[model samples]
Target: MHGKRVLLIVSGGIAAYKSLELIRLLTQAGCGVRCVLTEGGAQFVTPLSLQALSGEPVHTTLWSLTDESEMGHIALSRSADLVVVCPASADILARMAQGLASDIATTLLLATDTPVLVAPAMNVRMWQHAATRANMATLRDRGIHVVGPDDGIMACNEFGPGRLAEPPVILATIASLLAREPVPQDLAGRHALVTAGPTHEPIDPVRYIANRSSGRQGYAIAAALSARGAGVTLVSGPVSLPAPPGVALVPVETASDMLAACEAALPADIAVLAAAVGDWRVTHPGTAKLKKRPGQPAAPLSLTVNPDILASLSAPGPRRPALVIGFAAETEDLLANAADKRRRKGCDWIVANDVSLPGDGSPGVMGGDRNQVHLVTADGTEAWPSLDKREVADRLAARIAAHLAPHSLIRNSP
Candidate 1:
């Protein structure tokens, strides 16, 4: 684990002091450790002590002007190979589960797409509380690894299972995680531009037209690309999802905005147009809410075609990305339509998926975790099995790496 970096979050509780030992163990094992001390955690251990142990400055609040200028929270969140939350108190866990970014620790957790390992520590009762249980389940569902809150005597003297795991155990787990196969950085110096989520075309102040995209797939793609060491710029529409680590995020709402953002992030090596942009938008959105009146005719909604983001980005130009991939969400004739879309959009490839409801009543692909897709290219079509969105992202990212690998040599040639 030499040269591996770990972002250690020290939360509240008597167990917070143990994190200092954990830091020492991590550093001793040749891993660089950066500490983020929660306000509640600071009471038990001083920032000076943590800095001394980790051989790095400690982050306490989100308002560090120097830190922000040097390395912003987004950068700090992704700088580490893995993020460990030692002595993760109930409060911090709850805040993390609820997507709260009120503090530096929680904010980093929210912004990070890096693998996270959290060690919970609190009173036995708090650990067993319904809310805490739910929070742990949520975190686990989101793929956060947990070490232990082993049963033992606690600071409260009333315990069943709410003690932080020993430093050695945490260190061992960290080692095991670092020992896993490292991601291949084939796109080491490449840049990728990705668009995600549903573009909302407003009809009025409150009402809008949009798709059912949850942005999960696109976010996963961005994360996957970032994992391969590509500098990614994710142009996303409004969605209730956290930003992927190691990627710059440009948030927009309307299709026009998304198109503008995509253009601004040009000259990328790869462009994945995954957003379900609205085909048409309100020609003249109402200045006020279109009121409903009983026994009255509805308001006439005029629509106009929005910009074709895929074609625009795929246009032959010096700024055009080497590989342009577009998505075709079809309800029927998936492969045929996807191929046609690839030809029409002028993109190099099209990822086609069926968005129609399965007769079995299972959740559809638009807002779901799993997807079955077909890759349509000038050569032929390749069918992929039903897989988790992240798996698909990884596979797609690997293919992208393979596609760009040969060109990289030429680009780097003297």
Candidate 2:
């Protein structure tokens, strides 16, 4: 952990002040701290202050005479082992997602090939907006790690999200990133099947019913599996996300489409049903828009149940993977519901998550970033501590990959 190089990107947000304390923590941990402050970020913190705390000259300008003596922006950006964005404001996130680099901070972020860890800070309302939510999902799909915008009182005094995580948590998180030991290529010849996004049920030709699933978690799992040298088949619902590298992606709109795609890509080593498949779909979608009439209001639409993908695949079927896993999103009696779902679905494992109020902005869960889930199986259930979605994916993927090991998993197979 010592001597690990970290470049901290401090953007303009009320949480900029926390970067100072984070620098102290990182330096004390024997890690080198180099900082770059955005123009808007300079409002709350200065280059001189960050430089003093970091014990190195802060790169505050995109075009600096002394720093760019030999190689210019690209070299400067790729020099670090990792780039950490603390107090990553809403504007900075948007800029990063849009590939806009008009300033020093955004320039380095765009130019670097190194992985980035972002700790977001903004108003709860802005954080909850659909656009911001989409941007975050985009970043995570690209393997960008996110720390937190933990729940608490913000600088504006509102009690909600948009709070940057504390310095200690940020430091530990950076250390964790550096400690990544991706699973080996033991699964090189193996195949993985993943499902993601919300299944849209057609109500009419123009409109459809869907959930708030951003497809972040499923995409993350696909990426993680690919990194471990497995052939990945990603069956995604209607989502605006780029497919991960080395993945065979089949984009589908509705649950029926997704099921068909999954069935076609069968006989895999593992199957993870992460998509939030709709339980019901419109019985008969109107061919054209039904205009509102005075006497007879819009007729109540009939509904029909959809196929259960997890159970269908796991019921000793022709395409049943070696390990079939399901996800249970419950508001109450989490373990019980997940356990029941696991037994009924005939899946080997069930990842149970409590999607009550939005989580404290960790990543990969749903709606919000952080996720507290239960890993349930016929043997028993174990509660996973609340962690960012990235950590959860990495850990869970490793477990799935290890299940292919003959000795450790053969006798324990459910």
Candidate 3:
């Protein structure tokens, strides 16, 4: 990163303030920073401020007579090792998706072939809007990298994702992308199956049982596996996250659906069951909404055990994956329970974490980005320090690669 050059595009939104910090981090890391500020972005932060931090002229217009005389936009676009869109507003994303060159920022984006990354920031509604979703999907399909719009409350007083990711997270992503080597082909001929999010067990048409899983970890794992040249199929439960690029997505609702999907994806080289599947479901769910009785105690509902997806996939059979991994999300006895679960479920490994709420009552790993997990295997347990979910995914994928290397396993085992 020391000699890297970054073209930073600042777009509108309250998150535009974060771009300043990002610039500082980039420069302090010895990277050359050049900024292109959109008109909407100027409303949140001034060009002078960006210039002060970048130690360079901030380009805010496409029609500068002196600047265009030297084809500045083209230079700026091609000069960087990477291009990052911080607080990528809905408007800019749409423009990029539609190939709109109406502004200098989009014009540069359109002209450059440099690797691009976007951190979206908008109202939660806008972020979830069908149009925005489509645009993001299109961008991802075109090979653009997306960091995050973390889940949280926003300046608009609305909650449930759309906040710009913290500067450190964005910076780490940038570092990962910039320092990345040629895509590793260690798992090129292999196939991977990954499960994510929380299963929704319906008690009625209007009510359901679920857990607080944002699906970030699972999605990151899928992305990591794909990056390592493995074909990935992600069987996802109900989650707000977008599908990772290069991974096939099979969305399901209940535990049974997820199990069916996983079985259908059989013969995989690896399987990582990261979904927080419900242990039980209503024995007999009501066909319609269950009405409340006037001033009476609530009706008791019966529950039955759901299918054990992990155990089913881990069964000893020719079609079983060479390596099956399960996740143990526990509140107590993290290692003890995780080790027992690995043995009982017959999985090759267990990734365990304590999802209990912190003493300060802040959000925990269930819905947060960072995690501290222990890798439990037949030999021993290795505790990993807290890290971003993507980092965790990279480390886990690397371990899988090592485990599957030639001579690591008996490929012909029954």
Q: Would you give me the overall lDDT of model 2? A: 0.83
lDDT of 3 by residue, 1-414 (tens): 899999999999889999999999999999899999999999999999999999999999999999999998998899999999998999999999999999899999999989999999999899888788768756764567888889899998899879999998999989999998876778777889999999999999999999988787888899989989888999999986678878999999999999999998877889999999999999999999999989989978999999999999999999789899999998998999999999999999999999895732122357765688999999999999877677788899999998888633333211
TM-score of 2: 0.86
Off by over 4 Å in 3: 1-3, 10-32, 39-57, 62-79, 84-103, 106-177, 359-364, 407-414
- The digit string of per-residue lDDT tens for model 1 on 29-96 reads 89999999999999899999999999998999999998888657889899999999998999999999
Top TM-score prediction, candidate number? 2
Which candidate number maximizes lDDT?
3
Q: Which pairs of residues collide in candidate 1?
A: none
Model 1 / residue 57 / CA error / Å? 32
Residue 6, candidate 3: C-alpha displacement in angstroms: 1.7
How high is each candidate's TM-score?
0.62, 0.86, 0.73
Question: Over 4 Å off in model 1, which ranges?
Answer: 1-96, 99-179, 359-364, 409-414
Please state the error at residue 255 of candidate 2 in Å. Answer: 2.0
Encode model 2's per-residue lDDT on 214-282: one tens digit a residue. Answer: 777788888887777778999999887888888888999888898899888877778899999999899
Can you rank all candidates by TM-score, best first? Answer: 2, 3, 1
The residue pairs that clash in candidate 3, if any, are none
> By the TM-score metric, which is better: model 1 or model 3?
3
Worst lDDT 10-window in candidate 3: 405-414
Which wins on lDDT, candidate 1 or candidate 3?
Answer: 3
